[model samples]
Target: MIKLSGVIITFNEERNIEKCLQSLVNVVDEIVVVDSFSTDNTKRICLKYNVKFIEQKFLGYIEQKNFALGHASNNVIVSLDGDEALSEELQESIITLKSNWQFDGYYCNRFNNFCGQWIKHSDWYPNKKLRVFDKRFAEWKGINPHDEIVLKDHRKAGKLKGDILHWTYQSYSEFNAKTEYFSTIAAQAYFEKGKKAPFYKLIWNPFWAFFKAYFLRLGFLDGNNGYIISKETGKITYLKYKKLRKLYSNN
Candidate 1:
């Protein structure tokens, strides 16, 4: 069986860290947590579990995750957010995979909980993430706050059963705050990449975002949660573009 190292990066994640670590108790061989010097009970709660905790400056999301990946003692790594945990079936799936070690990378579906609602649609369910992988083959990439694992040479990937239970926003206030934070990062990333948000795109994109999520994606099936997601999806889209435009105007 291959030894698996579970890695997570956090800052002030006291509310979620314990649950995240508990879920990995029997699933991985070791747990490594790289924290950004949280001044909260995040570090205190993490100490309750058998985790290798290290503190570092607040790096960008992608950089911080890559930094956490570096501290893993094993090459077979399972990276998860502090707000995410393995479902029962996912734990079993990983346990089986550990015994065989078949794939270089494994993709799993993530089910998100938004404001106490298990969002099944609204572009939320079946949110496939490549969280488990051989470190030598993959690394965290993409813009900050929207990092993803990119495999070298476009290697073949395997799918895992079950889900990563993502405990997302528990309130609209939190949702809006996170949206603004992510939009700022996204706008800056776009500006650095020489990408522009034209006037039309600034207007039409949000409308399309809402339509795609609510209508095409069948988000309405989730009721109020779906509506909120669709609405916020548009809001985030608008904010990203608006911020991008501001970045250009300021120059």
Candidate 2:
């Protein structure tokens, strides 16, 4: 049987870490947490789980995760964010893979919980992420705000059965706050990568962002939460390009 290690990166994730750890208790042989020196109860809670907790400075998403992978004991590493938990079905699927390792990496659907409901539409559901992978075969890449676990080759991959439950936002206000923060990061990353914001990006991109989520992705069917999500997505798109334009004009 292949020994699987679960790795996570955290800052102030005390609220979610316990539940996240609970879900992985039986699925992974070892649990490793690379904490970004949070000045909260996060470290204490991690201690309760007896996970291999290593304090690391907060780098960009890709760097921090790659650093975490170096600390993982097993070849089959399941990387999860502190705010994410494995669903029961996903846990079972990973367990099966532990006994019969078949693929170089496993992609799973991630369902985000916003406010109080599990969002099914809103360009949120089935947010496929490559969370489980063989350390020797894949490396995390992408700009600062976005990171992807690019396998040695995309062909050496497989999909898993269930979703990774993402506890995204506790309130609308918090969601909005994060949206602004993420947009800045995304915009800066784009600018650094020599991506220019055309006039259409500032206007058309936001409209298409909403349209893609609300209509093309059938977000309207998910009801009020869906509309709210789509609207927020539009705002995020606007902010990203606005920031990008600012960077472009300044530089």
Query: Which prediction has the highest lDDT against the true structure?
Result: 1
The global C-alpha lDDT for each of the candidates, from Candidate 1 onward, is 0.92, 0.91
Give the per-residue lDDT digits (tens) of candidate 1, residues 1-251: 79999999989998888889998989999999999999999999999989999999988999999988999999999889999999999999999997788778999999999988899997898889999999999999998778999989978789999999999998999998999999999999999999989999878999999999999999999999899999999988999999999999999
Tell me, what's the RMSD of every candidate? 0.9, 1.1
Candidate 2 residue-wise lDDT, 1-251, digit = tens: 89989999999998899989998889999999999999999999999986999999988899999999999889999989999999999999999997788889999999999888998886898889999999999999998777889998564889999999999888889989989999999998898789989988889999999999999999998888899899999999999999999998897
Determine the C-alpha RMSD for candidate 2 after optimal superposition of all C-alphas.
1.1
CA shift of 89, model 1, Å: 0.5
Show how many residue pairs clash in every candidate, following the order shown. Answer: 0, 0
Measured by TM-score, how close is model 1 to the native structure?
A: 0.98
